[model samples]
Target: MMIQMELSMLNRNGTLVSEEETEEVTGIHCENLVIAFAVSNSPDFRSIRIIKTIKMCSHCHTFAKLVSEKYKRQILIKDPNCLHKFKGGKCSCEDYW
Candidate 1:
């Protein structure tokens, strides 16, 4: 399910790359992929909450902000380190994490 979601997201965002070019899209994390999939498929949802086991990287954080802004949805991501609330292309962390 996760793999499918990632593939779908990569395809939709035109981020899918060949083996040698994988580094170019390293910013596309699992959380970002899942959230993108959920948002795209569930139009009725106005907000999204995600629990991540590890601390989210800066790229994932930025991705979440972008997703929230693009979808006009509030996104709450709780990782081991902190709670990140994203809305209108901004994150509660202020890019600290």
Candidate 2:
């Protein structure tokens, strides 16, 4: 994900809800993490949208669901549990957890 001011702010304030968004992380915490960035041509943004790919845990599946519904975004998460697609307030799990 793009390192926004939010990243530094969270590091300084220790208000980070999730360290999975940090840089140069090591150890088990660092495994299966992929962060990428892409820019949009929209005049309003003149900036890139950051994308993060960390292996989601079961709980983050819920988080992804909420985020997709709230923001109208597409999130395809790979986890030990399953591949999760959160789109249009719908999940691919079909009631399975």
Candidate 3:
């Protein structure tokens, strides 16, 4: 089954940050909450797809890549800017976005 989730904001240190704190907090960005949900609910789903209205931040992108590699699952994310296919600890965007 395919699952879609809303992103949550987190700081560089992995602490939850509020939306109002985003501007002043330079290192705050969205977190990959979908991965956690997928892990617990969809063991048979090897490939995952995510759609976001905004471009994914670097931290979330890296998290997705690492999860894909560690779990041996393929993750495809489509954002407003580009499509990121992550596998084997690498992303199709090559860290461009």
Top lDDT prediction, candidate number: 3
For model 1, the stretches where C-alpha displacement exceeds 4 angstroms are: 1-28
Clashing pairs in 3: none
Q: Worst lDDT window (10 residues) for model 1?
A: 1-10
Q: What is the lDDT, from 0 to 100, of the residue 19 in candidate 1? A: 26
Better of 1 and 3 by TM-score: 3
lDDT of 2 by residue, 1-97 (tens): 3434233225556775454655434222321222122112123223222333545554445655665565566655555556666676677885375
Whole-structure CA lDDT of model 1: 0.72
Model 2 scores worst on lDDT over the 10 consecutive residues at 30-39
lDDT of each residue in 1-97, candidate 1, tens digit only: 2223323234456775542233345544667767877787766455777777667877778888888888888888899889999998999988997
Using lDDT as the measure, name the better of candidate 1 and candidate 2.
1
Cα displacement (Å) at residue 78, model 1: 0.4
Query: For candidate 3, what is the lDDT?
Result: 0.74
Assess the local accuracy of residue 41 in candidate 1 as a C-alpha lDDT between 0 and 100: 71
Cα-based lDDT at residue 48, candidate 3: 79
